[model samples]
Target chain A: MSAATEAPLLELDGLVTEFRTGGAWHAALRGVSFALARNETLALVGESGCGKSVTALSIMGLLPPANSRIAAGRIRFAGRDLVGLSEEAMRKLRGNEISMIFQEPMTSLNPVLTVGFQVAESLRYHRGMEGQAARRAALELLDQVKIPAAAQRFDDYPHQFSGGMRQRVMIAMALACRPKLLLADEPTTALDVTIQAQVLALLAELKSAYGMAMIFITHNLGVVASIADRVAVMYAGAIVETAAVDELFARPTHPYTEALLRTIPRVDEDSAGLAAIPGQVPPLSAMPPGCRFAPRCALREAECEATDPALAPLPAAADHRVRCRVRAPATAAPRHA
Target chain B: MPEPMLEVAGLRKFFEVKRGFPRATTVTVRALDGISFTVGAGQSFGLVGESGCGKSTAGRAVLRLIEPDEGRVAFKGEDVLAAGKERLRALRRKMQIVFQDPYASLNPRRMIGKALTEPMRVHGVGAPGERVARAELLLAEVGLPKNAMTRYPHEFSGGQRQRIGIARALTLEPELIVADEPVSALDVSIQSQILLLLQGLQERRRLSFIFISHDLGVVRYFCQSMAVMYLGRIVETGPIPAIFKEPLHPYTKMLRDASPVPDPTRKVAMLRIEGEVPSAVNPPAGCHFHTRCPHAMEICRKAYPEWTPLGDGRGVACHLHKV
Candidate 1:
């Protein structure tokens, strides 16, 4: 691969995104960093208010302008830092080089406009395609997302579509430009299980066909297991663990990850009883001083409460990194040594 | 076995919705079409289905919160639908429901203590002082601190509010509780906490629960037996283990295959059926699932299949299983 191809398609270096609450800025994303390669799917797994959605908003430059801003760090997409880019410059990249789909398609889509017109708007805006060309492209995109009878339903409004069909329309709109990167935030969370399976399958097929890198943000571990190539488990505004999907599921290093895995009731196996983590995710404004998870972590140490732990790579596998004082110590010797 | 705690026979609920333009037509939405199930004393029976499949409707109908249009609901062999106003009011003390959204179910302005004690007060179960004591005890039982009683609903987190909801349900010492998606709104860690709490309450109180949920994993863990509904009809009904291991109805099989398991090795099954669930108002003729069933036959489209008993509390309503 050439150097350009070898480089990560998107990289976040110590990204800190903050939102102003009660007249004081509180960090929603605290020193979060990750790299996404071409055509790879990275799942951002976390509970609600864990800053997964905030991370996607940060990348898309969709964060609220009045109260929220990138406090520090860089968000580099294809060798360009998105943080300092002008709105005009960012607008050109958005929906062309990168696109996003939200959880509630009903809220995301324009109610008054026809589904076809909404989809074609993206093509006309990004690619400057007009008239017949844009319409044809939009129809094809709808068909690609497997919206049945795309031509017949093209003129139908958003309300005409069901929950699953509306989500298909949202996917159609996001994939219209064949963007290099796609940010899907709980795209199938609103749909039924059967519909969710179809959507997940469609996303997987479309990702490979388009060869697009994707950041899939969801709280569903089952979804993360199915769709993600690599997984970044977040908690209290930080990435607690990141590793290959198989390795992460097999050997979850972080205490939070381990506890979360045990908590989910599996359909495949008859779980005796789920082990519930006692404390909830701390509020962002009242975050703990040291390790954010130390208060709820089972393997907490005296030092854990005194100092925050850096995300350090495990000796067993360099790619499998974890943020913990006790588990993955910074001075741990490499396995090869 | 001892007489079942709750027996529902041909329970039906239909809603007439007005649609169209100037020449409007009354459409009959068959939310619960002749669904029947029994919950033995202290047994957890789950009603599982996708959205609009009528699981929630079934839960509501059994409690008579929404009066059913037809069929019989018997509590301990007592005809619930036929009960007089005073008789029904007494019966209400034994039957209660916990809604899905804890925030919406609770009154934001009312203190948690008031919410918990009000049901007891209405039923005239205890004196004012005793009701307050019981409210605090219930709060402690649900794992909430005593201080939580004085706080408003908004003061607590989603999980804490759910605990309050559960505590409120227990204020009347109901024998059968219709927990409609109680843990669905909670986070994974918090979901487990709530599940364990419910499980503990079930064991200690020996309460029977009619658990309603869309998540197969949650249903499997919480329910001993379950009925998989599709467009207001039970497609498959049996022990959770049997049905999960060998699903008879194609709809049940699809639901089982479609549910994403936490394990990465087991790839989510490619759903053979396509298209969203048909509208309940105008469900397809014959088997409602025929429109999506991969193995759908001419007979399936012409007439609904009869329930086929498989012995040992197992049954299926599908042409494929009709022997």
Candidate 2:
């Protein structure tokens, strides 16, 4: 096997990304870590301002230098540590070996450039393929993403395409280089529900056909269950739990995950009433010590109030695991086939 | 149901768009074209559609925030359009509105206490201390802390700000409140909390609410009756259970399928709404949803379908459902 195949496609080890704001260092990601295998789809699921997108940006080296910094961590992709990589080196690595598709296409893509040029510019720069060759590749990628009239509409600008079509162009641009890893950050939030399903299905098909490792970041558990192979629940910049999709949905170990899951409206449910999470997410600057979710968690214990929980394997925990001080001794087993 | 709390018939509002430097030819954005619905006393009615479907316009029309070119809004057996300025202002005290953007709706320069009390002051209800006590009670009803009265809008989070907006609306103690996309801007977990609060307040106060939103799931959970709007027209009007379980109109079905349910294993059959919603400035003839409707017949393209009742109180304007 090749070295890239032997090693994980992307491996993060104890990644700590901090921001220096108001003259005090605030750690957004506290020793958060995970590994992405080739052709695997891992979902980073959490509520708003939960550091999921920040984690994605850290991987892409796109964080603003003024406020944020990677205090300490190892971001290894295909056996290369990206922590200390030069700007030029990182720029070269981006959009070629690795690519990212942000949340909103209308904002992400340049309004001044043609859709074709936006996609082909990366091909021309990364692969040094110029003129007709790059243009041809761009059209082919658009067609692959199921954009209609790709040859004719490649000249259209970002505003000309509808929300769903613009997102397709974004996907086409991200897949131009056939990158080994694709980081999608809330790719379907701006689109309407029907359009969201189409984009998600397109991503699933494209991931399988290209065998690309995808880090799908979102707050919607429904999206995760439909597409994710494994799920990681994050809170206050920490991976509170990780498990197979079915296992996590059937039985969430962390109190935060359980509360988050219960708060969502279910398809099978017929109740006219909503089950609400009582409190809002705590601000990062004034987060309480110990369990970050203690204020909102229903089953919070005294132990949860005194000590910070670390990711650990419960006595009967499956490959599934939880990061909490007072987890039940018995692992939450799969309840569904 | 005792003449209903509010009844709208043939409501239409067309905005004349000015174009070019000279502003020669005018284009009209048919924001609301002959839409109708009724909100029963102490009942919560939902108006749902995608962004530009005129759901907000319908809510505003009911409150007379915007004057309609044609149609009538009968509020408690009296016509709102025919009411004089003094009468309208007097009627306004009975019908209030809670806007969608809490941050923008409330004056940023004003304190929460002043914002809440100002409405009651204008209506000339009670003295200062009584108003203050009432405002504090309303704030507590919406779940904001008592100390929140002294703070500014910027100091509060989205959910808290929304509660302040609710408190301000409750200051009037109106029988009907027009809530326009009240919780869409907040996060999902926080959205549920606001919904529960609204539901609780609606019950405890026996307030009638016309809830306008693009989110079908939230509407299904919160509203007993719902009207599905499309391009400034009501395509489906029925009870929530009937509409969700057996949606008669194509657009209604598409909307139902579009909502993201929490169940991961539920493979929702793919039913997409074709093309972007047609601009309200130049809507096609016949059915408003005909351009994108999958079940559109030949007659639907050329002629508008009349409101057809489907045995029960449920009514739909689709040709396929007509009998």
* The best candidate in terms of TM-score: 1
TM-score of each: 0.98, 0.93
lDDT value for model 1: 0.91
Q: What are the candidates' individual DockQ scores?
A: 0.78, 0.50
lDDT of 2 by residue, B1-323 (tens): 43499998999998898854445678888899998889999999999987777989888888889888999999998999999999999899889898888999988999899999999899899999999999988888888888888989999999889999888888888999999999888887888889889888988889999999887877878888999988898989998878888899898888787666655666444435455567788888998788878887899999989999875569999888768
Q: Model 1: which residue pairs collide?
A: none
True contact recovery of candidate 1: 0.72
Off by over 4 Å in 2: A1-6, A314-317, A328-337, B1-3, B18-26, B270-274
RMSD of 1: 2.1
Residue B6 in candidate 2, Cα distance off native in Å: 0.8
CAPRI quality band, candidate 2: medium
